[model samples]
Target: GESVGLHLPTLSVQEGDNSIINCAYSNSASDYFIWYKQESGKGPQFIIDIRSNMDKRQGQRVTVLLNKTVKHLSLQIAATQPGDSAVYFCAEITSNTGKLIFGQGTTLQVKP
Candidate 1:
């Protein structure tokens, strides 16, 4: 059976430190990958994204790495702050359809 979801339920980090969030996906046919950050009461906000053709992409303070061979994905946040505390989710979209399949979310807690 095929599966699409997150690998962890939560992550804890100290303020001013870096944070690494991991996710595992199942569909090798998926073409697009995205990382989103959701706050306490807000919708998921886009962080970074990568296509299947690429293995890595970098944003302002975030980096998204994609490994198609093992079907793994990771998000790295630089200088994580208290404000960065939120639930993070990884989503994938295939070119065949516009629908996006979201993985189980991982809660990120930043300790000051």
Candidate 2:
């Protein structure tokens, strides 16, 4: 629930650059996809989401794409900024499992 003490993979990008974070999900039946951003000392915050029936969805400066063919998911951030530096996670939930699964985690580092 908290990102207070976690070591995650890192993805560095320059300011105003586009950043793409990818995740591979193991469950083919997962019906819901969600992307979360967790800054230090806080719980993961919702960024964007895509339904299994949808190939792509966009929210503000963020875009989420779902590839059922490869069981892959990705989040794209346009014009990355310093405030965007945080741990990003991809989550999937299925009706039968009733539990949300989170990706390994990736820390986005926006450099000046």
Candidate 3:
């Protein structure tokens, strides 16, 4: 599947501001979730991940949160910069299938 959908949600932020990206997953059985950042014409890069057993996890400058009740996930980026501008995606991997199903991406546009 294409990483970026035809109509992606856009998130605009200022430099040095915190950015929060949200996603809604479909499968309740998915046990693992990963966040990816894709720059223009570049492949997706691993950002952070969270497992079903955990509700929240933090990375170098990012945080991932999972809510099973609503099948919701969110990524928080601290002190967003122009370099952080890109399309962000959330993927879910079910233990049984071992397949990564990518959700719709959100384009992050950063202002200087």
Each candidate's TM vs. the true structure? Answer: 0.95, 0.91, 0.91
lDDT tens digits by residue: candidate 2, 1-112: 3111113388999999999998888778888988999999999999998989999999999999888998888899999999999999998888787788887799999999
Candidate 3 lDDT by residue in tens digits, 11-102:
99999999999988767788998999999999999999999999999999999988899888899999999999999988989898788888
Whole-model Cα lDDT of every candidate shown, in order: 0.91, 0.86, 0.87
Which stretches of model 1 miss by more than 4 angstroms?
none
Q: What C-alpha lDDT does candidate 1 achieve relative to the native structure?
A: 0.91
- Per residue, candidate 1 scores C-alpha lDDT tens digits across 20-73 of 999888888888999999998899999899999999999998999999999999
RMSD of each: 1.1, 4.5, 3.1
- Cα lDDT of candidate 2 equals 0.86
Leading candidate by lDDT: 1
Q: What TM-score does model 2 achieve against the real structure?
A: 0.91
List where candidate 3 sits over 4 angstroms from the true fold.
1-8
Q: Evaluate candidate 1 by giving its C-alpha RMSD to the native, one decimal.
A: 1.1
Report the lDDT of model 1 for residue 51.
96
Please list the residue runs of candidate 2 whose C-alpha ends up more than 4 Å from where it truly belongs after superposition.
1-8
Give the winner by TM-score: 1 or 2. 1
Residue 8, model 1, lDDT: 77
